[model samples]
Target: MKVTKTSSNITYDIEGLDAETLLSLYRNMLKPRLIEEKMLILLRQGKISKWFSGIGQEAISVGVTMAMQKDEYILPMHRNLGVFTTREVPLYRLFAQWQGKASGFTKGRDRSFHFGTQQYKIVGMISHLGPQLGVADGIALASKLKNKNQVTAVFTGEGGTSEGDFHEALNVASVWQLPVLFCVENNGYGLSTPTNEQYNCEHIADRGKGYGIESHIIDGNNITEVYIKVSALAESIRKNPRPILLEFKTFRMRGHEEASGTKYVPQELMDMWSAKDPLLNFQAFLKENDLLNDVDEVEIKEAIVHEINEHLEVAFAEENIIPDKTEELNDVFKPFDYQEIISENVFEEIRFVDAISESLKQSMEKHDDLVIMGQDVADYGGVFKITDGFLEQFGKDRVRNTPICESAIVEAAMGLSITGIKSVVEMQFADFVSSGFNPVVNYLAKTHYRWNQNADVVIRMPCGGGVAAGPFHSQTNEAWFTKTPGLKVVYPAFPYDAKGLLATAINDPNPVLFFEHKGLYRSIRQDVPKDYYTLHFGKASMLKNGEDITIISYGAAVHWALETLKNNPDISADIIDLRTLQPLDTETIYASVKKTGKAIILQEDSLFGGIASDISALIMEHCFKYLDAPVKRVASMETPIPFASQLEQQYLPKNEFEAELKALLAY
Candidate 1:
């Protein structure tokens, strides 16, 4: 709620730092500006594909990054090139990155600020600028939990302040009182839209009061003011461990990217900002303080230009790693050693919910750093009561109850992964995932493939409908994520599969979507191990073996298939329960279909564009000659799940499953 605005015209009273540090800051600021100018030249020559020029806004990136400790983390935006330069990231690697060479951070998988490296403690922003805010919160949360005196500084533009992620991340960080410095570089324009079209608030920092966090605004063009204010604020946050929103009011001297012309910006405004440029203003400050003169500035600029040219030559000489098919295929997810779960043979009967709860409990005990976060998950023990007694047993630090910010929660999990901490996120209901889909699909799912960064998080989705919970709450939307690469989808049907697969998912080094059917939570009980065990993904469990036909299904539909067979004992089948939808068990499916010569795929999701369609195609492609009839698919109608009991029952496709099976057998 506290706000401070530095005046545009103010006398400098530099405090708490010596002349050497001041000169270093000037050098850091100059290097990036020079680098940007050089990169612009290369862009014109078609040497680099594109460049997001941060010409006018060097002070914000330089001051914030230089103010933070070397060991601390930073998530820089596209225009914050000074952050990387200030952090002393190797110039050769950066040049290689700009040139899309193999030596680049992402090995040409991505360019610009679309990559991140844990080695440099710099996790850059994806094209979606706002998600990195939540990621910053996660890293700060990890620091707090581990008692590490590290503060994370994350950058975003003024336009990104309007994203839902901005609010959600701030709210979560404030509620948790995390050690995070939220830096907003108000660079006048987001791409082409001016600040007038962005928000109605007096200033972007004004919105910080709504989240109960401290706020500040500064003349971002003044490097001295930026360094002094941000240094004090970052130190305060590091010591007290709370988020503070700092808005750096600056202007984008050039277009968003070189390709986009700045014709929309008024010449007078551009001229006004040009005179107040960060580099020029800082040079004047140095001269006035007797620290730097015209000759010293020339030497510094010449040295930086020489350094950049040498690195540029090396980067140009390095071959761009054109990934072969094998490398491209292997990079999607980190390779994990698959371990078979060895059971002690001691068994106990428990509900499906208990199985999940026990798996989480055991995993938390096994991995001291493991965290479980979701809405109402701590004291409320989740809406399904799956996490009952977890708060008392695991404590609040490990069993975190998050605000209703699914996007931030998922993003925080990604941050935790960056710090080598594993997390499990529970979506209150699978239907609510739409709100958090962007981070799940774009950030967490793509981190590994993009930069070799492992997103070690498990997102638990409570899905499906049998209790008539209406359209919004009941959804079997696994197909949405299954189609997304760099994600593993696990949906377990029985208590046994649920416990085993959940354990495996928590330990996996990739982002996993673990779907738990609400209908099967208490309705099914099975004898599972009292001790820990894991089940491998992409391996289907054959519940029943028969030669008549192959019945392939998963989640609640596996139960539905078993019940249908019980009612009609005349139908013989090889019932395959797919515990994991992605990294699909096509080998098992092909084996079943080839042996049976007739297969029927069952799903609770709508028929169109469902997992069944992909499976049917795979069957036809591999086992075509072995099939006696066309593959059959029985699915819920292509409509939103209904609320009425009769209509819902008809819409579920369970009743029609029997008829479909009989007809397929007759053929």
Candidate 2:
């Protein structure tokens, strides 16, 4: 390792960083402080609605960030002015962002400092707490596996130290030995509660020791110490990818962003710390060495002030505000391309579970950007061994086996994608998707809007009922995620379609949630393409052509539809398999029902609001005249999926597939 470990107690290193660096540190601190002070005044004067201040802890951002390469990624907390400025974001951009101008990042939807520049390799700054730590973990892990030379810096507060994400990220980072710099700005408070209230640990650096990674506690106010220590830390992590903690002992000078009225902070302590501030301290150190004089100081301050106002002038003068529609919409999921865009799918005979596994193998072979992570996904070859041989074929690095932390896994996917790496996240079971919902729904779903960014992050899990999976394991929670717009939901019923749909979902420009139903993993066989191919979303498959009735279904229900047609030839059937739900194939459904003159929606999920509801609603309005009879749905009764074998069989859409057809035949 090229990185030599430094002492924990050391607080200063005078020469590794020289006069120019010191002045730059001083200049960096002053600019954020000046902008923050100005923005605070703007908020008070009604010129700006709100702002968060990074007043006291400036040196950590300045020192560590200045030492890093331009291509390195930075995942920052809310109060990281020095780090943000260090990453090349102009003071005016920050002001413009605070003022809510469209020219601002994300064309004005996100606050300034929310999304990092793609050109600069700075990852988006998420507003939510704790999760970004795990996000940073994923990025570093990607770099480690892909052999990329970039390092990632993740910021969090002492309060976040108590969060599960914080601990999970550190554990994963250290275990994987990922190149990550975990900077915890312990500004003595995690909001109103003191560090003492949230944790008993003496220092954030101490927590790193528990993970067996290198750690340091520095005088966060000292520019030289922060710079030299972090440079050394970054060097080691970059080479060997181990988690490192750099805890800056600083204070949050201003009250937490909007909830402010300063009386709670004792005046005397504030005044004392104000006198020893980072900018003033760095300036004095430079002057003592005769590296900076009165003339340079005056020019630097003037230049920064001029830049802030110049950006603000454009920000205020530009009438670029996002419209009300985009405020609620935009970048949720990449829009789904309908049927016309699909390359034809080639069919081959194979079992469904093996079909699902083969798709995983094909994707792993196809894209350098594609990656898979989950428990038993490696040597154990996955619980069902669908991902078996992947670790041997692609190596353990690519087919990663994680320690069963769903939130961390999902957050890592978010962070990894932020760095331009497309990820495929898997859980041992679909039931486990609950653990990852916070990052999936709150962070990943709203990320682009919140950060004003774009990324293609994918999550695939085995779901649905039947096969005696019981309550916890067999779940069809597509409704839970289908409600979240940014995520693409897919359910392929046959071997041929599974291979093609999985390929299509992988290529989508937005986050996709592929629902690989456990029930149909290997119920039967079909001809799937031996070569690579794709199937577009918002499209459906016509299983059999008929005139009397249309059976609309997905997942296992589609198979049931085919079985029903075998028993009843009198009722001619047209079965449509809805591969992707969110961007549904309404056109195909209506067209099929129009021709058939009657329609039936079938699903393996408990009735109310399933894909059947959405599909049936479209028919009642658009295809009513085409329908000779009322539309019907064959779905599980409104009850939890049962555990008993006989009840479970009776509970699902089995006999109904035939019964619905017979009813249509009678009509």
Candidate 3:
């Protein structure tokens, strides 16, 4: 390849790139520029609700996208309209997305640039902006594992660099030597805050050096420089498989969105950047080089304007689809296959912790695409030693230890799931999920609903209190995830159920929050099957049968119900252990409540907004006529679990539950 040097001695390869490719780059930039202008007119006319202008920085998106191969993936930010246009997504589809039509990628569920599509190999960013970096790590990881030789280009703004995900994604990608290009388009301000207020570093690329990643700074106004540098870097990464952070020094000519005007930006600065606009500079370059003259420039822009007008007419004529009740409720989660396993006489008495280990081992043996990740999960066997021997058995590749980055790993799991890789993420302590809350609720839980993508990932949460682990470590936070629509919450009481439900959670087509009570890890034991077996979600296990009263609970509280029933032998009650909290097994609860005519819901989580509240309301709604008395609930006190044993004992729901159970029975 022949290299050409600029006056500043910056080199770019020009021989290998054809004239058609060069002209195509100009065309790509022109499409978004024209579309943005038309969309601004629409915004003023009330035809579209919002627009994130890529007016001045089209070179960055177009350059990076043209650099990447079609098979490779690109996770774009809000101002990356050039990426969508260059990728050849239909003009009508883009218009529909902007107009919030059902024909759009998210089916009118989300607005501009907030949706991802597998069809175009484009993963869109959530409003959080940072998690997509980690998601890019996962996509690159999948590509590396599959030997696809594909490099993922993930874009972020200067403000997003302040996010923890940027650090986490860079660190992991460098450590793993995955093929990822972290592109930062520093458009001077994040919303209204300037780069100076966002970070202390001089350049965003400086942070990547701290993560041990190779870093670069480019003249983003010059499309030739961006395309040449990014293309070379991407190709090198594809061959050598590593991460590089490139800071594209560009400017956003328009406001953050159409509604937010550029009043905060200085007039002189705006004029200075406008004079160096990427479209004008690139067009001038093409003309100077005799690649594109006045006629070519006018014809190219005219064609783009005509195309935009044609697409707008069609999009305006199309009717918007509003989802009805059934459509709205359905499609949040993909269907899970329920398989019942017959007893094979092979059984071993094992503790709950051992059953968990056995379940993971069996599942790993079954699924080749399955990966296990978390802090100290590889060699240290995790904090509780549940994976004590997994490193030796599964190898470092399968049983990988991650940095102490809860948010990034969770989003990475989401990224992996989109590529058909199933991941089991162990939150060392369930309380740490607070750090990953945004990714779980916003990204993982909502991705499927937005774009019909399956998040085939399971987050194993070691939750609940009884062993005096205090408030942070010991928390029955299943209710938090149960409230999220796309997530499945599973909490098993016995060793047999733990093993079986885990297998089912691993196989489920959506994200499952599998809660494992640390207190019950060693205390509970059962004759769990030696062979692989799967249980079904939305199904409750009938522990003991009675007709006097019904006890409803899950997790460690299910054991409490069992112990309470055992102590009060005179109280004949149907003990319903709800293995899955989200699905609720409402039918079983209703059946047992109708049969017994009395019910008491139990939980280890505090009373306010507990899963018990939902179950209680459900029983009252469905089993009202069959009840002998008003349904009662027994839950932990509305306070953080204490460190002292006595305070913890007082805070727990065991005694309270027993009392509530007896009172409901007597009524």
Candidate 4:
């Protein structure tokens, strides 16, 4: 393709030339520009809180979107107003979203561009810029695994290229050769941080070559050029899957938001770009080629203005659905039909680690779309050999070994889960989860509440301090995630509970943090059911019953409590093992505490801000009348786990639990 420039217009010599398509492109670009202008007016009038304008970059968004198939997925950023317009998103719905009305896509949960329509195959971006790129990579992986001819277009800014997720996503996409388009809107500045400050590279596309993927750069202001180039690229990707990074060099005319002025931008640079405005340039081209008459242009503009006005009126009349306080707890976990079973046949004996591996194998066999991904998980069988022989059992496609990028691991799972795939991710150690905490807490935990979407992903965490594994390798971090809504935290001590709970977590429709104590990996053994079985979350297992005192514990602490009970046979006490943390089995604990009239909560984490504190508070509020003594808690000291075996032994609360139980009984 070649471009010819005349005094009044520019023309392109493309194979499939049609006047109607060119007019539609101009019309699409104009619609978003007008809507953004209206939104700015609303922002000034205090009708809307803020506005992120896509004034001069419409050509890039509209051109790329028009090239994509309707069924293909598009994960858009804040400034991709042209994307929504090209996808035929109703103008009124966009207005209602900005107005924070209940009828909006997010049901008034999220304001601004943080909303997406599942029906349209669009996933909206959060305030964070880089994680969504990894999510789009997972979507493309899902499409490739399912043998679907679909492409996922992910948009990001020039500043986003600096994030670690950007590199991680690009590497994974290229390695897997998935059909994904990394559209970088290089507008020169990332919220006042110039390109020079962000990176030393000359162009963002230069980084793509290092990842072994093809890269291209184009003038973002030219509509016909972007449309033709992206269209051809999309077709090639669908035919033979692979990732391609495209850099659209454009400029943001307005500031980051309406409140922020353009004072930071140099006046000379602004003047230089203003002369090549995409809408004006495209209109001039249309007029010069005689493709659009003045009357046609006027009619199109009038139609768009009328439609936007009608939508605005309707949206303003609609009521905002303020969320009720009670509804906050709802939709955190999807409800499922569960039944308890008593097996008649002899159970198969297995170790804790083997049971976990077996459960993963069973889940993969049951669901073809279920995928297991982590660092060294495929051929090496994970860091702990928990996934041994998984690659041969389930091919490389289902069992993927990812790079040492924790954020991308979790975000990609979020992406796959949204596209009808169940993902199970393993953190090498629970302590290392801090790297991916942003996506885990902000994105995965809130997706269901914010967009009414399911994040069907399970993050396997091997936690707790024991066997002298220092601070980095061992830590009981369940309390950190239990406070987060939209996540289910499950910790099992017995092999039976570990296997059954893993199955339930894999099947649950919400994100789950499955904590497996590394100390119990080979040390514990039990008779697990050979057939498939699921253990219910938010339920406590009463190991032994006594009327004196109730000892509540989970994970490795449950075994310590059991051993304490065995040593002191005369001190009769009831033991309640909590299988799940987030959905605390308060009902069971309340009943046990009422029967015993005394309670002792045990944990292996630090004494401060542990799950035991939450349980102690619950006992005080619900079972205070029946309590014969204050609910005691036995937990590790408020310090990091030591590397030495003796110090590590003292660091845990195993020995303290027995003394606490004896004191509770004596009280």
Candidate 5:
């Protein structure tokens, strides 16, 4: 499988490739080109909204896909239409998706290229280009752990290499030696910016050396060269299980999209690249080799065009199916049979951090596919020492320490989850979760709704501000995710709740943000059950029952509420601890509020647009008639957590909660 260089073009030792396989590759390239041309026509006629063409880059898609096994996964970008065709994805399904019909993969929830079908082992692209690289790495990681010989091929453009996820994915893949092929379709221009402007490297493949991965540069227009090189690389990767960075030097003949005219592209440069179009060049090559006669060429063209026309006609004739309004509320989280847990008589007093670590250990023991990955999580046992001794128990393969790439960690976890391997990702600090917010909100949270795919990932976020960890270290970012539609946000107060909630989050078939208050990690210790048990999400635990007023809180705020109640012996209030925030325990809160006829909502986050606002509104909406006084909210002031101990204490809502509670009781 050696490559031979020539003056004008490259040749590969592809003597084994028969005429039939060569013809099939050509057809694969031609079919996409014809379909893209039809898509442009549809756009002009106002039949479609937009299109991203893979006119000049079809060789890379067809070549690389032809090299892959049928069971191997493909995470495709918008321009990889040839990959879809090679995977045997129906042209009608693609058309139906473009037309926003329910028959499509996403059931019309997502249109165009933002969709994927599990049936084809393809995960469609999100708007962000780089995250899918990490996801592909995760899929490969899963394959290695499950003892499956599968490689995951992920596509990105030259522009996408600029993203941090590109570096993160390559580094992780190389370190773990996962079987993944990173296909960088270096097609000259990223939207309007050329390669020189996007990167300083001579070639995108040059960066692979820094990550210690095998890399190669191939003439993407030459189908034979691409197929031979990629096939050899894919075969080697399956045996050795290491990532290879392969850069395909090709061009995009059209503008980025239909509405984006060719004004940005220079005519001379376009003319030069257009001559090297993979479809036309391959057609000429076949004629030169006497592999494709004129009749054979005409027949292939007619057959492809006829198939495209038939699919388009049927797809266009079909009614565009809008999802039912009720469906919008559904599929945010997969339905689970509620399992009742009987508390065990055996109990052990454990710290909050130990509870989390124990739950992760138990989950891993129960499900062999559960993987824990994060910064300093393996050898150092994490910055908080929550995962201490985990590496010894689970080994480095399952317990992994990753580079400081929050986005990649979460995105990779999503990929693993999609492939039936549940992953737990720990952000070093909850405040740092903002770095990975794009994937968390756009991909992980939305995957279930978009394609009915279960992104069974649990993100362990150590949140809240109490210790003098300052603005960067101690910030409560729960409100940010709580506002997002398809995420389950859980914040635990004590060790008992922490263990149960984390266990539940690991088993749930959706993305769960398990927030452990850093302040309470070592401080809170209680006798938690030794036996396995799960706490139901969207349920509240009552700490105290009183007739005068109700105090509703979660996380560290719940402890403050309990302490406030203890000090105020005369003030009788019902205290409720909401374990999970997204599926809020409104019924529990409403019942407590109805009984007391007064309510006070509290949290550690900023006052404006915080969880308190939502709880206050909920009480007003559901328990308005039962209330004797207006629902009050006590939350941290609208300011960043200060570094000084005194300022931080003043900035928090501990004192505020007591005052608000007394006022409510007095009223």
Candidate 6:
């Protein structure tokens, strides 16, 4: 593929431009380049730890940011130094991050390039290419929900287009028509490999057409062209809200990073790109347009040098970057306290679905920063209609609808959560959570532990079996995270518990996993709270007390156990509801098991490596002495949950309390 020459040039685009925008663009690009160059010097002098230079792509960064309005979000690539430099990141913080200072916004835990904050209207950068491509889509999705005309601009390298995330993000962006602009810095190489060897496609922009995303190409080195193209694209994006890819063809003036010298770059190729320097090209454009007077140009260069030096001085002096401490260690086995949470139900006779809905309503009413987003959650209430009338009641921003990108959806929720907003993520199907594991496990679950700051995001997963949801939809995967520390897990059986538990989960300082049973979506009926009521995470409800044996269950299983207990009057059996499983209510379990002198751990999940095992272990460790007979655990057999009712009942443990209770009584 060869470069396309357009009729319009810098002189044509700016018919009679004020010197301000042009000079500002030139000044921005020059500062970042000099910063990168100065940083490289620092790295060599042993004053800095790591450095990734963005010398080649200055034009795209400066142009795109210059065109973007204030308060609009910008998600940058590691190479877009100009964007972050212009956007609220103080030079000192950027320098401080590289120097390994704790004063860095992320407390210096995050790498230097992985910076800026959503609260600052500057979506943070992710170094791993293609991973953050979908981030802009999420911010745009939020803007659409808020009924706010905000355009989110995301930067990427030409090599990033090859990543699967790129395709997934762009497709979702186009399908939902999100107001996002994908800016690609096509610097002719994916690290060492050139574009010719990397991909056969003529342009990355062309790939967007297949997904129905409007796209364009521009001279990335020409800041004027970059600004004009982004301006036009951003306007169209906010209006129709469709995905558009803008390929900015440019070159990197320096090697990839401080340590990486261009061993592969040929002398001829280097000479050719030398004249195409974006900073120099912009300087010439400004000179030709009479925007660059000799005195003004000298002042711009001097000011930047002074600014960079000042940043270096403060950054090194700042006491940041805590050396890895042994004190940072936390036990995976330990449980968090549920004492801060207080809960009580007010209303009576409400549906289980309404319980969840009311909890969100009450929480949203109380907390102004709460954000709700997922597929079909905006105009429509949701798949189960649990969110029915939510959009109409709350308006779009707080209750949002999103394109079906599960990973991006959860990630954005994680981002919002870190910003002090209580964000509730709607996973249309609980099984879809596999798509979002990286951010959930790597970032959200570990954020607080990594730093002193907590991640208070709540992921609302509509889970469970009994709905003929085949292989992908019916599985119970909460066990995957039950073992994970720093996460509070909740599964409510009744409407009262549902409302109370949900409120508690949302308010917790740690990340919370809320698995709502699909079968109970419209099943059980009971009274819920009108005002906010929170249930403790570690508390276990003693559903029914019996002297014969103890039955421990939760979620849908709790309802089944209750039904079984009512019919069996001969055997005095006690029932325990394990409200929140992470910090399992061992006290309640220990007390009930000691009283009954027998215990049966029951659950819908498979018998192998499931929660039942955890409960059984808890009994053996604490309540084993209380057992009059051997402890028993009843769970579904190890097999894919079958669709047929009879097959499912046979494969799954069904009402085993009758036989189990009789056996225990005779013992």
Candidate 3 has a TM-score of: 0.97
Better of 2 and 6 by lDDT: 2
Listed per model in order, the count of residue pairs whose N, CA or C atoms clash below 3 Å is: 0, 12, 0, 0, 0, 9
Residue lDDT tens for model 4, 325-405: 766567555665665544455688899998999889988998887999998999999988988898998999999998888
Q: What is the lDDT of residue 368 in candidate 1?
A: 92
Q: How well is each residue in 48-83 modelled by candidate 5, as lDDT tens digits?
A: 887998888999999999999988999889999998
lDDT of every model, 2 decimals: 0.90, 0.77, 0.88, 0.88, 0.87, 0.75
The weakest ten consecutive residues by lDDT in model 3 span 3-12
Better of 4 and 6 by lDDT: 4
State the displacement of the C-alpha of residue 71, model 4, in Å, after optimal TM-score superposition.
0.6
Query: Model 4: residues >4 Å from true position, as ranges?
Result: 1-5, 8-15, 339-345
lDDT of 2 by residue, 325-425 (tens): 86557555545453323435665688888777887788788777678888878899888878878887888777889987888888888777776677788
- Shift in Å, residue 580, candidate 4: 0.5
Question: What does candidate 6's lDDT look like per residue over 443-471, in tens digits?
Answer: 56655653444666788888878877766
lDDT of model 2, residue 262: 59
Decide which is better by lDDT, 1 or 3. 1
Candidate 1, run of 10 with poorest lDDT: 1-10
Candidate no. 1 TM-score: 0.97
